[model samples]
Target: MSWTVHVGTILHLLDPTANPRQCLDRLWEEVEKWTSIDGIWLQCLPGHLQPSGTVLVGRCPDNADEIANLASPATASLNTDGLPVVARQLRDGNVPVALILVSHHHQPQPAGFLVDALSRYLLDRLRLQLEASELAEENHYLRSSLTPQVMQHDILTVSGLMETVIRSAIRTAPSNATVLITGETGTGKELLARLVHSHSTRSHKPLVTVNAGALAAPLLESELFGHVKGAYTGADQDRKGLFEVADGGTIFLDEVGELSLEGQVRLLRVLQERTITRVGDHRCIPVDVRVIAATHRDLSREVAQGRFRQDLYFRLNVVSLTVPPLRQRTEDIPLLINHFLQKCNRENYKQVEDVPRKVLEILQAYPWPGNVRELENCVQKVVVLASGNTFHEDLIPPTIRSYINEPHPLEHMSLGSSHSQDSSIPQNPLDNLRQALEHYASNAGPNIGECFHHIERLLITHALNKERGVKLRAAKLLGINRVTLDRKLVEFDLDVKRGIGVIEPLVDASES
Candidate 1:
């Protein structure tokens, strides 16, 4: 069938080049010359609305309104003056664009095939052009900017500690030496590994990651070194392992400490010889792959205790990088909270604005056991359950609330009486604190830190109360800066109003 392909509205993409208006004028000029048509219809909506497939693009020879009416939902297929009009929707990056082909003969399937092929090529060209434009803009911005920017990745960190880590990772990424990432679980070890892979010369190749702790000994071995057909009971067909799959790329071995003794020997041999022998196979097949192993366990300790092999440990420890736990770098919490909140909000379709100051204090106070992973989960939980834009202290997990609810150590300081007011007590404040802790410890709660935090809150409140709500005076009395005193006031929810320091208890709503 003889057919003429017509371009419909291009969705999502706007002309990014300089002088878009002139470009559009020139585009129409070329279209008229190519199609031998005078003009076509063009519509640019103000907001992000899906383009109707029947909307005319450029200029239509027939009346645009009449054509739209003829191509309405009721008129699926049509014949206009012995010409068959077929329209199909094509998606470019989830944005749909309509492609119409008018054929002199009635051959719907072939016309559709031709339209789809043409649309695919158009979409591919558009994507390539868009990417090129973006890259050029990015290069220009980076060259003009003074600050060094991290490569585009999901990692969000403003902490100096993380900046150093990122710099180190970038520096070492090009090398082929095995990298050993040591950190507590959820500290973004795998993310760093992937970052290294992305920056490496072999970035164009595959990256296969396997969790050494997740599988049994035999399965882990088979997964790492492949298996021949009839090698085991379930081996119906020969299978390539992760090493083979990751050839010319990087293979990340997470929780490498969990590997059994035999598995360690096999891994060490592979690292040394750059080859692997399939299960039940004598032949040693050469494979080229970089190894990036990670674990929370201390490999040196494991080796000393005979749980892990010394040679294998040495092989993987060529370039060791330690990721610090979240508690040590609490300064990054605000940035992290903002990042994860935006993420969870988008994913959960919520509109959480920010974490309230009181809630931030609680999150900052609690020692994150699961590190960044736990913090992310906590943010997700709060966002999913948030009733409004602001996240309050009450939304925090009960364990945290309970931990912050200790007796303030300086509770008696507000009484304005010396410890000797009772003859049984020592005059020293430290003595008073010790006695208070002993009494509180008798109740058997989580830890001493929780009790100590209570004392800290009490001391700050007493200082504020003594100063009659003047932050400057309170900071001087507490021997701290105004910034620290302000933080303490927020942490303890100590509202200083009307010459009084009122402590707001972080009580669970259910209990209240």
Candidate 2:
């Protein structure tokens, strides 16, 4: 966090050579007390100066002739060189560098050539300083902002694929090549485009996005390439298109595969020539723009089917990236669910606690056809409906409920099998019934009839256990009219009172 400032002074007159260093030293002493500054620099004679941990020196020429004459055996060796050497050193330093040109006196204007050279040199240094500072600040900010987002976007759980694409995109962002991002519809292809733009040299400029699918062919072309006045009936005044507006920046073409063949050809020509001809004007206006295209459709298949031009496909696919769908990474579902729940809570101004284990199981079991977008919507719905601290099964969308009831692969077991043998423990009838009910309830089939039957049996068994075999009391405990419980007992062909009093024949004999 230490900030160092390099100050270089060029002495034009040699008459007061001894006093120049003294003046620089005094300036350094004064600047040292400034809290923001960590260090200072004082240039002694050309190519020679003292060095300190907090201060250093270098050779600075006062005029172009002096600069031209000073040279060294090796370029790395600092000598009395021209402004180029100073510029190189300033760039090499980690901290900001400032150039101060000292004349014999504080004249209103030094000689024009001297003033011009000094001004140019100072400007160059200032530009470098600004660029370095901007880059540092941006890096720091992005690290803080994007570190947490990595978890949010990691929902796809395809970190390897995403990392490869991100790294490749970053490497190619500075170049003029067009990038094509292809993926399933909710896989965040547009987000990837923004990421590329953010890391590119053109990040300072606007990233204009155009949804090709939303616009008609003619309008799409005009929107992308601009239209001149009187080009059409509705054309009132000259208009700048996306390409013109996104000059020196990136133009993100979303759903680029939806573009008509003719539009694709025009876009291809623009990419190839780096120029665009307005809808009406015959003149071609050169545009400097980076093209980043995204599409959910399979462009290659579209090209093969003659829907998309092969040439245009090749032009746009200079660097292709594929974002993986969410289902492929089941492990990330819980993480994504949490992120969506938090987002919903913030938007709706509600406090939601933990997602119930049953709800999570339901979410994980269902095959998400709409991908991440569907999952996000599902979470929002649950958050909206949630009342208590814990989200319950009732909050889950009906479409996902069946999956949660689907029987596990290990549900069926024979009585003599290892699983049944370990689970079978001689115990009170109520205890055995409770265990059986728990198992059946947890393994309820996806069929609603089967699930309902399991739930009703569990409720009856629990009530009977609580009433200790008293049929009338058990019926009352279940909150059912006595006649209804009596009908259920007869329907199940079970004498609730007798069954509860009876013990296992083997256990009774052993006790005797």
Candidate 3:
């Protein structure tokens, strides 16, 4: 078998002498040429320039570098500055810089050493360019990938918040304190319980998991604390209960909120005494086991309602962990999408290159009521239905479409109630504006200001869409003059000259 070697080429341009407009034009040309290369192309900007010009320097892969190098030396010299100029343009334009890795596999040739060295050189140059670039957004992909793997069954993805939870759970797992993993249904509560057990000191011991809500009172009692022969009409043979079986290990009780009062009493006894007696037999058996419980229902509320035991709730919640909903961190959507797509490709024996921008936009905009599990199901459906490299928006489920189109009641201002509501709410438009700005600011990293610019552009685009791409109407709706809107269109980096024939219906039409 021939050994495969992966080659990566990265080109970096440091300082350029050309004007911003010329720089951007040159950068786009170079990026187009390097589209087929097996590496990334990068451009850097000078530190002293104002943050108004396009910040992106030119970028292409190794293959593109080869093509550029093959050109006349005079042309290559211009091409060399091309990458830096693009980086400068992107910085000035305030576009968020996303570092992406594109991989390729090829059989090594006799000159592999030279090629490999060149690749390393290119990567070094790219890193230098990235450092010198005006944007300071940090990369988390590598750090995220290095997170300790949980039990394969426990967590589906190692997202930032999930990683924090897992790491915290690992540290607390060895102790005998009861662990409560809380989240919405299908958010992997049981998985977190098992992960706690697997990482605990009792790794070699058994882990017995029971669904507290699945069994009737009598059966659940026998299943948990075991039953002696002739304990009940059907009990003909002696059997160890979950607590007994989990000796020196862990016993996980899932859906703990569903446990009846009687069941909770028995469980509380076992937890407090560290011993259990089989039904129909008076002899108590001592067992050393850690208890990890999970629940989707709000146990505190259940306790308040007298449905669940308060003592049991307090015991189980010794170490509480809450899994964040997928909607809370929309930034992870791309990573999850790529992960699911790769899995589908492997299983279905199909190669898919691109996920259409519209599909991602819909995904980001939709509120995932069922969280990650629902998102995974949607991905599976898309993969099964996909016939080409691109995933079409039509393949998305109607439920997601409904979410995207759902009207916001707040958007409509009732003239009668507006005054009273405004009085009660005390119209602090400046404070509300500040809060919104801060929320976006905290999440946007170094590209906060740029991201804001993009958001403003998006708002303008929405206005244009509402007016059916009529510039005058859009400008009027936005409360800006046509000339001002035209300048804004350019500032937002929108293509004003292109016909807006393909604009989609505003997902949030009421808001628009």
Q: Write the per-residue lDDT of candidate 2 for residues 264-350, one digit (tens) a residue.
A: 878889988999988889998999999999999999899888899998889899998877665444445666766676789999887
**Model 3: per-residue Cα lDDT over 148-170, one tens digit each:** 55224356554545667778888
Summed backbone clashes in each candidate are 7, 0, 24
> What lDDT would each prediction earn against the true structure?
0.63, 0.59, 0.59
Instruction: Estimate the TM-score of every prediction.
Output: 0.53, 0.49, 0.52
Model 1, CA-based lDDT? 0.63
lDDT of 1 by residue, 232-275 (tens): 99899999989999999999999999988978888899999999
Instruction: List candidate 1 stretches off by more than 4 Å.
Output: 1-153, 407-512
Flag clash pairs in model 1. 39-59, 40-58, 40-59, 40-60, 41-58, 41-59, 409-455
Q: What value of lDDT does candidate 3 attain over all alpha carbons?
A: 0.59
Predicted structure with the largest lDDT when compared to the true one: 1
